[model samples]
Target chain A: MTASVPAIINEFLTGSFSTIINVLKVLIPLMILIEFLSVYHVMEKLSKKLTFVTKVLGFSPSAVLPLLVTVVMGVTYGAGTLMEMNEKEPLEKKDFILIAIFFFICHGIIETTAIWGTVGANVIIISAGRLMLAGAITMAAARLPFFKP
Target chain B: MDPVVQIIKTGFIKAIKTTLMLMKVVLPIYALVVIIKYSPVMPFLERAFEPAMRIFNLPGDAVVPLITGLFTDEYGAIAAASQFDFTAAELTTVAMIGLVCHSLPVEYALSRKIGLPAGKIVIYRILAAVVVGLIISRLGGVLL
Candidate 1:
């Protein structure tokens, strides 16, 4: 097919609908799970365990929940939680950078799997590479003079 | 009322809202890509991106997914890449780069919403993706 105008329009409409459906399948269930986890304070507990790492990353201990949430969930959800944290306790500019740097690289484990899994990509490298890259950036950012407030 | 059940209800509502917000971004971009794909400019785009993509050892057409993933999300990129014939290594390289830099407009806006320096964040993300992709291709060699 030469991709006539009608065909292009058809692809756009149907493609948008199907892609939205596909994303919802993963997102809804995951959102529900995240809610349950938050209600139970599971991330809070996990954040406690992540305190050492957050400290090393130049984040206040309060950043742990948002970090863990973003790690498992994604930037959208994690940013929402981070905003809530900000309202309550006002994070520093550097802390935002550190959190953003970490989450930028290492967000949405299951979401990444869902998208890339179909192509038979290497999940380990994708996930681990993100983790290491984010870790390295956070570490480097931590050492910057501006990082200390 | 059980607090757990209340939480579930709130979660459902939030999920619906987030899904709609996501659709607003995904739909327009998907439509845009569809239009671009059918246009005569695709070859020009492929040519323009060829040199940058060479670092990942991907074909010129692979720029489609990289660009789509940069502006939109993983799904759009996957949709574009599915149209091409690529080896597993090439696909993985694309996936990794997509992972690093996908969904810029919405995500960067969210960073700004959270009081971060959004422009700096976006620059950091793209650079990280490029550097990481280069390193991975060098190490794996198979991807090359």
Candidate 2:
């Protein structure tokens, strides 16, 4: 049995709407929490604490803002901040790639939560796997001759 | 102004903005997938994509979300996945791939804007996602 055009459209509308509803349930609260955290300067403290890790990752402490913001807000926000940093004072190419690798694997808490959590994916696997993989990849990439800064 | 009110106001506005941004990607893919299901192209495409997806122990239908998540966003992938019947492990693999690499075009553009090589970033991200998906699906029970 083939579905008609109208049926397809109906399915599309309802399907997308329902997905939006489901995603929003998790995303909205997290967005709110992220906003409040930033509003209360929690991100600043978090960024500060991450400085040691950044240094170990071969990035200057200034990379912290992009790293933290990306983890919370997504790639665009982090890129925006990185662009700003580049304008003020450029980051090393090695640090740039490392940060890119990190954010590429694990950015946007709301996005990860909504997409994975709504589908019954394991929280530990999604979160821990990405972090561990990102770390491993960045470490390996750091060993590359092109990455020497 | 009270601090509580300020937090609520800021959070509410941010949530609305984020939802709208997600809708931009999710709604279109949702419509596209719905239309594709009615069209004849799905079967041929499914057959072509199925072999690759099997490595992750996913159904042919899982290709929809994987491709959607690659070009668009994870929400679009989630929307596509919702239409199918997948086990928890399969869902975890799909979600893991989405987590590792989603919204590639936009992200690559962002990477370029930040002065990184777009092609390199895109290649690395997709490769990482594939490798991670394979590992997760194979060793999920033991490691996870």
Candidate 3:
């Protein structure tokens, strides 16, 4: 079944508008929080506690916030924090690749888990599978012959 | 300016800029996907994937939601998948694939903006989704 011509245009306009609103609502506050954290060195302190993640993912402490944001919020939101951090201190290419690999597989954890659950999906299995798959792959990748980070 | 005020001002400016950057890329992709979702392309895709879906232990008709989920969004895919009597295993398989690969055209563009290895990540995602689907389908008895 196909949508009629008018229906297509209608959905596009409304969909894009709502998407922008949703993005702005979350991003503005998150950006402010990030700036505040940076000025106060909050993320630095926080990242220190996550040495395990940094060691496992082979990324620096600075990568923790963006990586966590991507995991919880979604990619577009994560990209904002990532761009700012990378500008201040460029992450290595291998680290970026690993982050990307992890994000693509397992971002939007809370949201996808709930949404997918509505279709009779097992929430626990899906989330756990994604986390483990992404973690395992990224950890192995950090040790790859080609990517030295 | 007060220190707090300065932080707020700087944050808002950067947020607006990044939001604009994402909107520019996302809007066009959204429109194109909207059009494509309504085209004959969907029917062709449905027919093409029917036989292949057996590998995932999904019904042949499950391709409707699989393609919808890949091309559009997870919500649309769920709506389509709801039309079928999907067992927990089948649902998990489809949902896993959806989580990994939905909204591809828009997401791929956004990832490019962040200087990620977009193409490589996306390729891996597709392959991984297929693999996850297959694995989950085999674990049906354990699923709720």
Best-performing candidate as measured by TM-score: 2
Writing each residue's lDDT as its tens digit, candidate 1 over A52-136 gives 9976776778777888888887777788888888788877767777888888888987777665766566777777877888888
Rank list by DockQ: 2, 1, 3
Write model 2 residue lDDT over A9-89, tens digit each, in one string.
788888888888887787767767776776777867888888888756666787778888987777666777788888898
Which model is ahead, 1 or 3, in terms of lDDT?
1
Q: Name the runs in model 3 displaced over 4 angstroms.
A: A1-47, B1-48
**Residue A37 in model 1: lDDT:** 83
Stronger candidate by TM-score (1 vs 3): 1
**lDDT winner among the candidates?**
2
TM-score of chain A of each: 0.76, 0.83, 0.67
What would the TM-score be for candidate 3 when compared with the true structure?
Answer: 0.69
Clashes of each: 0, 0, 0
Each candidate: what lDDT? 0.78, 0.79, 0.75
Ranked candidates (lDDT, high to low): 2, 1, 3
TM-score-based ranking: 2, 1, 3
Query: In model 3, what is the error at residue A28, expressed in angstroms?
Result: 17
- Give model 2's docking category: medium
Going through the candidates in order, what fraction of the true interface contacts does each contain? Answer: 0.61, 0.79, 0.77
Candidate 2 chain B, which ten residues in sequence have the lowest lDDT sum?
Answer: B135-144
Candidate 2 colliding pairs: none
User: Comparing 1 and 2 by TM-score, which wins?
Assistant: 2
